[model samples]
Target: MDIKIIIDDKNIKTLTYDSPVLLSRVIRDSGCGFSFPCSGKGVCGKCRVRVTGCVSEADEREKKLTGENSAFRLACLTKATGDCELFLPDKNITALTDGLCSRYSHSPFGEGVGAAVDIGTTTVALYLYELENEKLLSVHSFANPQGIYGADVISRIEASLGEEKEKLRALISKGLEEGIAELCDKANINKEECKTAVVTGNAAMLSILLGEDVTGLSASPFTLADYFGKTVNINGMRTYIPRAISPFVGSDITCALISGSDIMKNEKLSLLVDIGTNGEMAIKKGDEIICCSCAAGPAFEGTGIRMGAPAREGAINRVWQERGKIKYSVIGDKAADGICGSALIDSLALFLSLKMTDETGLIKNPTVFEGQPAIEIADSGVYITQKDIRSAQLAKAAIRAGIDSLLNSCGAASEDLGRLILAGGFGSFISPENAEIIGLIPPGTAKRTVAVGNAAGMGASAILLSRQALEKSEITAKNAASLELATSDFFMKSYIDNMYFTKKD
Candidate 1:
């Protein structure tokens, strides 16, 4: 039977999909604005959808999630019986094209026109530059097409091992091609006019992009068959890829350090933490750099939370407590549709300060707030649930534990580093004060933290502009020491220790 879902919004037409599949899969296959935080495990309850058509009754997960008698159904748990009318969060749906950094200073390497692409797990940014004039010609941004598969690298690696790997690789390649074609068109040049393309990403991402097998990455002592950099010809353009440091810390981190090499020249000890599903961090002390990767999960990017969305329009990206009243700012200055990652941190801090939530992340459910384990962020009814709190706790704990592991390995404390550099989109948008309030970043590091927007993208640009920079990336990748978290007992201990909401006095 064909499944039909109708959005209750003006000018929005009904969506028809063939089914016998879970609604969550259909929603993602349809490329809608819906999210599945648990990757459709039915544990997060974030992929809720409403139906008025023929369908099986909600399952135990749905029933428990929605309080047994609720009208909405958990999309992952509910299977279709026949054609049905479905409703979506129309006003709150976000477009992925926004929140891209198109700004760049031309540092074109080689000669002629070229392009640099950063293939992030959640997003992709591309820049077209004229090497002759050192001018940045065009820029484009889009959501990583593979996001529908899952948010983190492991899900991606699993997807890459099965028959779906080809489909997955094609998705990213097509997105990159589209972005490249658009950049060429915007600059009024032909696709072949650009002679060079520099790409950077984590090992898994780069592996899939280059059509390499990912089975080795799934086991203990993760290994990459394609750790060595390669130059391939795509659409008549020579594409250059950098070597990965390890299976987890790929070339992107190398490029990030390269982009920030000037700052590191300050001759002070510092750390570069790239916040993403794969939280990659590097500790630099007098030319010696040690790095590690943590499975921070997708929670930080607004996945896995009910009423959570990406940093799209209407997403509550900011929240604060003003004289016992809660206030927030949305992504596009519209009404609160759903909370994004930044708002998640802000709400955690606010809840802790207001005593609405305890140190263990238990909601007090004060008499004034409907006696539910939730903190309402807006009058529009979008709120953070108890599971969302746990999700944040897990994500934050992984990062904090990763930091501690790095610190412990370096035999240093938080005060030893002169600067803590926060890179990537999530880190760039987050408020340091809120970050400090929740202990995501340790003490003394907050005031010295620098948010370097799109450091990986800038690093890719640097590679395109200078052969010396490209050479440095290779050397950096080879020299970088990757800490294996599995062998470290301290990581597990610190992970459990940091799981709760903590605020140092």
Candidate 2:
């Protein structure tokens, strides 16, 4: 039977299943953005959907989760028996870096136009550069359709080994193709004129796109990955996938080095943290640059919380304490949909200040509530649950621990750094003060921290434009060293000690 899925106030599409299937499976196969924080274990009720046709009865868990009076069904627990229409409820996400970018000019040697792309696990940004004229033809950004498979590289790797690899490959290819077409149309340029695309992503994404076996990249001792390091045709365009340094440290970080070379000059103690699902960091001490990848997961990007989402319309991106009352700011100047990562970090800190969450990261409200662990926000069915706190704890611990590990690698401490660069969009949106309060960033380094928005994309554009930038990326990849954090005892100890809302006393 065919199930018609309709996003509220958006387009509609119909898909088929040969037999009865879990709604979560159907949704996963659809390549749409929906939260499965518990990996569809039904423990987290984030995947709430409204169905309007033949569907099986909601179980006890669903009733307890959404209440008997509510019409929403847990997509993870519900089963679709017949043709039904369902709508996924999430504020439309329109995310691109608002942080200042390093300067770039499209100066490719050839006359043809080129598309520079940075395919993040959760988002994708494309820069259409006019090579000869050194002009930016157009820019387009969108969610990575493969996000439906999972939110992190680990999950993506598991799915890629099975039949789902082709689905992921096709989704990303289609997104790239559509983005190119959209940029060309927006700039009134012919599609044929754009014959080249320079793409950079982590090993998982690159492996899937290049149709290479990802076992070496995903399995234990993950030190192997194929960078292709050559040009190949993908969706009618000659795409150049750059050389990667390791399974975890991808070409994206190599590009970031090119973008942040100003701060990365020799004889300087600097740290670059590209915060994302994968926390990729590079610490420069003199001539050598040590890089490490921490599996930070997607909690920082707002994918794992009960009401978590991207920084978009209605997402509460900031929070503050005002006259003994907490105040918050939502993106797009709209009603609060969910608290984004930056705000969530701020909220955690705020809660700690207000004695809502203790130093041990436990929520203790003065007046007891039915949901023992959740702090309800404005009674709009939005909340920061206990699970959300634990997710933040894990993610922050990974990132902070990774930073400590990197610093240890270079025989330097956080106080020795002259500068700290936080790349990627998430890094830019975050307030360093709030981040420090929550122990996600070093407290002493807040003053010198700089968030260069989407440095990976900026570097990709530079590589597309200038010969020097391209050659620099190559050298950076060749010279960079990757550290395995899981093998470090200090990282493990730091992770355990840093799992609280505040630093260990």
Measured by TM-score, the strongest candidate is 2
Candidate 1 C-alpha lDDT tens digits along 8-94: 654244446565667776665665544455667777666667777788887665777676688888888887777766666553432
Model 2 C-alpha lDDT per residue in residues 329-418, reported as the tens digit of each score: 778867786778888888888888778888888888733333546886544445888778898999999999999899998888888988
Q: What is the lDDT of residue 126 in candidate 1?
A: 85
Q: How high a TM-score does candidate 1 get? A: 0.86
Write down the lDDT that model 1 would get.
Answer: 0.78
- Local accuracy by lDDT, each model: 0.78, 0.79
TM-score of 2: 0.92
Best by lDDT: 2
Instruction: Give per-residue lDDT, candidate 1, residue 158.
Output: 83
Model 1 lDDT-worst window of ten: 94-103
